[model samples]
Target: MQLPWMSRTDRRHWKSARTTAALGELMAQWLEGSISSRPGYTPRYGPEDETRPLVPTLAALCRAGYVTTCSQPGLVGWGADDAWWEQRAAVEGVVTDPVLLHRLVDAATTAGLLVRTIDYSRNAPGEAPIPVTTRNCETAGEFGGRISEADMAAQWRGLNPDLHDEVSHGTYVIILAPEYGPTGNRLWRILAGSVQEVGHAA
Candidate 1:
C-alpha cells in the first residue's frame, strides 16, 4: 500500500528501506543464535551503539503502519498490515519509530480494520519467556535482570501506591515511557492478558 506521509520520490525512502531490510536480515541471524556484525558498519562509540540501522527502518515502517511504540524503551509492536494500507490512504506523514507502527495497528484493530491474535509462551525451564510478536525473541528476557517476587512487589508498591488495593499475587511490573498513546496502551493490556493466560496454561 502507498503511505501518504511517506515521500515516494525521496532518496531517504530508499535508504531507509535498505536499512530496514538489513535489520530484518540481522534480526533473523540473531534469532538463529548467530552474531555477525554488519559489514562496513563500525561503531563510532560503544559496542551497544548499534541502533543506527534499526532507527530509520523503524521510522519507515512506522510511517507505513507496520509497527507501534510501546512503553518500554527500544521496544515496539507489530500492527495489522491490512490496516496500514487503509490508513495510508488518509494522509501523508513520517514514522520515526516502530512503536508508532504498533499504535497504528492498535488503532486499526479498534476501528475494526483488522482481526489479530496474541500468541505468547514461556521459555523452557531455566530459560526466559518468549514474546512471539517480536522479531527478536532472544532479547525478550533481557528487559530486566532477575528480581525476587517479593522485591518486584515492593518495587511496584513504591511506584504505584494506588495499586495497593489490587492483589499483587503473580503480578510483574515494569516501567515504560509516559508518552504512550491509546494504541500502545491497548497493546500492553493485550500482552499482559496473554502472559496471564500462558501462565495459567502452564
Candidate 2:
C-alpha cells in the first residue's frame, strides 16, 4: 500500500514516549510478519504493489556494528540536528563525538564499508571550503590557524560577508560513507567528527 505522506506538523507523533514504544513494538512484529495496528494508528511499509527487494536488514547491520548516525523518526530533514543525533547515539550506539570519529572510521573499514577521509585542515582551499562549523572559535585569527585566509574568505557568502560570523573557527574532519550495495538507502557523513547522515544536505 502507498503510505500516506506525513506532514511536517504531524511528525510530532514520533517524538512522544508512547509512540516511540509503539513503533518499536510494531517493528518487532513487522519483522515477524505479524504486524497489527491499534485504533487510528498504523505502520507503513513501501508500496505493496511493488516487489520488495531483498536488502541487508537493520538487525544485520547492527549485528555487524555498522551504525549510522541516523535514527528512528528519521524524517527528510533534521538530519544531524541535536535531537536526532542524540537519539542515534543513545539508542543505536552510533558514534557521535568527533574525538572518536577515527574509531568509528576504523570500525567501518573493519566492517568492510566503503570509507573516505578528507582532512580539510591540511588540504588546499577548493572553490568552496567544506561547510563545517563549531561554536568555539571566535575570531579570524582562530579561523586562520585551522585554514588559510583565502579559504576563510571562501566560507564567507551572501550580502553580508560575515554571514557565518557566529560560527567559530575550526578545521573540518570529514568522513564520507558513500553509497554501497548492501545498505541500500543509507549514506553517512562524519562532519567535524560528528556522525550524521549525508542526507542532511538533501
Which candidate leads in TM-score? 2
Off by over 4 Å in 2: 1-98, 125-202
- What lDDT is obtained when candidate 1 is compared to the true structure? 0.29
Per-model lDDT: 0.29, 0.29
Clashes of each: 12, 2
Residue-level lDDT tens digits of model 2 in 19-59: 22233333333333443221122433321221122112432
- Return the lDDT, model 1, position 2: 29
lDDT of 2: 0.29
